[model samples]
Target: MTLPLIHTPYAQVRQALLDHTEIALLDVREEDPFAQAHPLFAANLPLGRIELDAWQRIPRLDTVVVVYDNGEGLAERAVRKLQSLGYQRVSLLAGGLQGWRDAGGELFRDVNVPSKAFGELVEAQRHTPSLPAEEVLALQQQQADVVVLDARRFDEYQTMSIPGAISVPGAELVLRARTLAPDPRTRIIVNCAGRTRSIIGTQSLVNAGLPNPVSALRNGTIGWTLAGQALDHGADRRAGEVTPAQRAQAAQDARAVAQRAGVRHASLADLERFAAERGRTTYRFDVRSPEEFAAGHLPGFRSAPGGQLVQETDVSAPVRGARIVLVDDDGARAHMTASWLTQMGWEVWVLDGVDRSAFTDTGPAPATLPRPSRPVDWIAPATLAEQLANEAPGQTAVINLTTSANHVKRHIPGAWFVLRTDLERALSTIPSAKRYVLTCGSSLLAQYAVEEVAQATGARVLVLEGGNQAWADAGLPTAEGEQRLASPRTDRYRRPYEGTDNPREAMQGYLDWEFGLVAQLARDGTHGFQVL
Candidate 1:
């Protein structure tokens, strides 16, 4: 039976934000759909991976939580799941997403709408100088002492970039810009896949008082592509580390910006107290590059590069209204990143005087602590092979719960790909069998559905021990491609920026979607932004 959903109207939700009340606005859908349309503050907590991330993302169990969906009936399901996880205060956004529209609420498009809108607003207010794609292309053609820098992730820069552009990511610009082009005459042009990062990055240099002539590539690579320009693929150019003097300048500039934004500097003792406080969630992030973080870093701090942290705050700190403390070996990155958080209406803090020698880790701490153990019946590969060889030929059924993409790649012979949600209806269609064996990539996912299957169909539902990996390791041959699918392939959505087979239409569609977010924010009017 579906559990009854507690509903909160858009008016009360909007009022909470206005009154500075603490609440988490969640969008429980896949990343792609969540990117297409969501509120400025709604965090995307996909239902498929909710079990893995919910605890770390939503640390305080008693915190007020509100979840919404695009009428997919996912909100109700998510509410029940959160309740099952011991969340005391949980409610669904009444009437799904449509209800928000009916109540005159604003709907935004694209992931990180808040950051993107902030960048756009910064440009509107500051009039941060920028040159259109046409002019930048001319400069590149002329080789007029211009150094192009991509402010997006390195992989994104490698995927598609302006010819001769170097990867300098967002926060790195302030620290490493001088060394890359020490000659003050060398004009600096910053770009990203789209407008936000480029705008934010260009403004960062301008705000830092860089001596070089700085300007954003108008609208970034999207505008470049739209202007019928070529993007270099598989480019490997990158920037080097900061010099001692450059580092000092970066630290001084960043601290000033953070102070101007009212971002407090917290000591180790202050952070300790914040962590120990009951009914409060505190996120400690090391705002440095992955390589720097990998060498050694703080014990509790996670590696979130300063640039990406500002761009994807929801992924970093899902608990809205929670205290955030950023750490970095170089004072620049953390303070610079925290400045953005402050303007974005977050209660952000920067750690001061931490010993760099104390840090000694490679990655962030696990999102959840000590996961609950759930037992799944063992189905060894050799035993399953013997069962498959039975004379009846249909006595035992093998169901794979891996992604459709993975199932299409390789799967056990005669295994039917199925979705956990559609397993009941799917079981009815499979040939009459004495037992049903469920497997995913590792059977971890299948284990969650095993008990439900037995309760519904009264069949002996056994989980494949070690799943397909064990089968392959046991020298069992597997099949390739989609042969049998018990459910439709609706579990995953294709990203426009993913893979190389693009028809140009999809890329343009993505840009068009981003172009509209500014207007959406205007209509929504609930975002409490104080641009610094």
Candidate 2:
């Protein structure tokens, strides 16, 4: 029997990436090659891993795997192994990374945070000198013609920056810098939290082959902090302004950038119209931190970090060819994200004014059908307790999904405190349940556990609301026995920078990028920032 194959062109690969479609971009090159630079969506499983453990990473036998490498040697081997593993459809990217690059396809740097990558572009270029706090003070005394461009986000700039520095985020610098420093030699200086963005910003101008000599504020605000320099937290201080004409121009520029990257922006009315009448599935993602999401989000919008949304659009949306609309306050986060999504191939839109109004739950109701279950599950304490007390005349079982600390303090009788992380491999221990209740800290995890188990064995499963806390809060009885076993140690809670090599490396890069944030905030003033 012949295996399914799809040999796609560089343009098609780029389009698949922009659409956020379910196309696995597997780079067969070794880790080091990938770290230097590769397609943004590409994951380096390496040729060895695929030959040995392709099934582990590429678990779904039916995933559309598109293999590529710098050249072609390893990819052919990968396709054979993938085919052996029952991956029904597998194909090679026609020209691989070289082809994409040769076609003038843009490549993404290994920037950790999606937002931070945007922050990297907001400063000037130069071979200018860095002034220590004392030197800057001295320069002030000397009445130097230097202007401090605070290359940080607006909010951070508002909190504190160099007293006289103006704001310009890294991504917007090229578009806004000329007006801010129209003169050829303005003695421009850039500063961020620690350094990366400031250095990158200054260097970007130099690389742009700009004539002005720019310099980064050495060590940025952190150096200021280390220098014991005082910060100005005064209210009513104005940041740089974005005129209406400038706003219009910026929107146009952003649109063009999006086009280059394949991102789309949609109005609220357009989104509403799509949602109101949809033959195709449409996912409304709130691309913000969980803290921001918990603070408030648009109704019916699921909280998916921008990178995660782009990376796991298949799992998040599941429905192929769904329309994706992302909500964020400004164009930086949305446009930058939209750029990646556009390359993926989904009908994508970035909605403005997401944070302007409170979320009104007036949209169509969620599908009432039960979600497909998985092999493992977690449940709440209250629901678990109820299920335990009223089980059938068989050996019913229950597992506690709480921390060791909480389990030691209190747990339901006869319930084993299994770490929710172990639920997958530990499923073998689950006795043929008259039923099993998976209890956890909250209903959220428990609900997921129930779904997982249901998918695996069609087990009768239930999750408790409020989890163990709810049970304890209800004055439920406790068993004070020492735990005979330890919970499984899982890194599920740690969200790593999902880029090149290990997550730690990605996170470190992200941190380095974030360190330069305070400076970017100051350079790009916050006039047009809408929190929604």
Mark the 10 consecutive residues where model 2 has the least summed lDDT: 523-532
TM-score against native, each model: 0.88, 0.42
Off by over 4 Å in 2: 1-424, 427-436, 444-462, 466-469, 472-487, 491-532
Best-performing candidate as measured by lDDT: 1
Q: Please list the residue runs of candidate 1 whose C-alpha ends up more than 4 Å from where it truly belongs after superposition.
A: 1-5, 369-374, 379-446, 462-506
Tens-digit per-residue lDDT, 1-532, candidate 2: 7665567787776665445455667776555555455654566665543433354345456666788877737678678767766777688988777876787665543323223333332322223345566676567568876777765555656666777777665544544555576576776777766555565455434433345557778767665655667656532333355566654554455555566655566777887787676244567777654445666667767666554454344335533345778875445445544554554445678886554566544333232222323444445555555656786644556567665556667776766666543455456665566566766665444554565456555667766667767777988776756553334422122223221123444445545655554454344222111110
Model 1 TM-score is 0.88
lDDT of 2 at 211: 51
Candidate 1 pairs with clashing backbones? 297-359
* Every candidate's lDDT: 0.81, 0.57
Most accurate candidate by TM-score: 1
lDDT of 1 by residue, 74-189 (tens): 78777887887878889999887888878888877667777888788788778989999999999988879999999998888888888889999898888888888899899999
